[model samples]
Target: MYVYLSKIVPLFLMPLGLIIFAAVLVLLLLVTGRRRLAAWLLSFTVLLLWLAAMPIVAGSLYGRLESRFPPEPLARIPVSSCIVVLGGAVGLPFAPRQDIELTEAVDRVYKAVQLYREGKANRVFVAAGNQPRSESGPSEAALIGELLVEWGVPADAIQLEGRSRNTRENAVNIKPMLEATGCDRSLLVTSAAHMQRALASFKEVGLYAYPVSTDVRAIRRTEYTAMDFLPDAHALAMTSDAIREWMGQKVYQWNGWN
Candidate 1:
């Protein structure tokens, strides 16, 4: 229940969700015959959305988290005993397409592959964080594992973990697998915005992880084009993700999972 609530409750706290919430409140005010107040609230909501969609605002919010663990060259990073890539990189095959649908965060997988090929570890734990029997189809781990093997990573080198749906769960579920790897140190790979929560949760589980973050965003915009001020759907989505990652860290800390 906590898992489901954690996913659902954050919606109302982010950009689009907050906009919808305010819209509903405005509607209620209109139904109560408070036309002037409803108009005022509607205007406020529109402005909020516009600000959220602006690249400057969105990038500023996410940049803090994404820059926390900036990308480093493979040679600079110490080779750990194991590499774990968190889920959220791909979608399962369904219906018309049998191919995996890679998301923007697919760098998570590519980075893991690079680490493996470079002899960083003997095993790569590919976590798609879904139940194996997800009605949507196979777990993302299977697709990623398949991709890794096809990309020349040996099948024996990939350990597919399909039972985690979030960072906290990833830390919890992978502890045993990490133990089996018989390595004193391990590298945790995920989007830069997620490294904070991922590292914290792993610490709570008694595992000290080496942070290897990818998919960085702007920590600061040095120059602004006109596009920076314009409203963008992608910017709005980035804002939503930033809001969630920050809030999720707080929630985890509150629950003693961080």
Candidate 2:
């Protein structure tokens, strides 16, 4: 119940949920003949949606998170005991689909492979999981491990921690494996915006990892064009994602997970 609650409870605080709630309230007010209250709520919801879909707003939210961990070249980072790649890259071939569809975060997997090939680490640790009621199949760690082997990484060098379903669980589940392998230090590969929470979670579990970020979405510009103020679907998605990340990190802090 707690695991499911962890996943579902945060939605109520996000833009979509709040908008929906406000809209429903507006309708209720109208049914109760409270026209003025309904009008105010309807107007507020529209304004909220407009701001959330603006590229300028999206850019600012993403920039704050992505800018925290700037990318470093392979040469600049010292070789670590192992490479830890967090999940959200790809999933197994479910029924009706024989091929895995990779996500934007698939760069995490590619970067891990590059680090291994470049001798940055001899071993790679993939930390991923499926939700409680996910389609029954291989865990994401197994899928990622297979990809690593297909991409030239030796099969024996890959370690899979597949039961973790969130950032906190990722750190907790991988703890014993790192201890058993004596991987006292690691290179953590994940999306740039996600690195802040990922790094903190790992540290909470006593793992010392250096950041290796990828999939940065923040636009680098001293100024924005007029188009940036226009509403866009992609901008809305970015804004939602940035808000989720912020909310997740705050929740993690409150729970002492990081």
Model 2 stretches with alpha carbons more than 4 Å out: none
- Tens-digit lDDT track of model 1 for 127-155: 66664345367777888898888888899
Global fold similarity of model 1 (TM-score): 0.94
Best by the lDDT measure: 2
Residue pairs clashing in model 2 are none
Each model's lDDT comes to 0.86, 0.91
Question: Candidate 2, residues 201-232: lDDT per residue as tens digits?
Answer: 99998899999998888878887789899989
State the weakest 10-residue window (summed lDDT) of model 2: 130-139
Global Cα lDDT for candidate 2: 0.91
lDDT of model 1 at residue 139?
77
Candidate 1 segments whose C-alpha is farther than 4 A from its true place: 131-136
- Judge candidate 1 against the unseen true structure and give its global Cα lDDT, from 0 to 1: 0.86
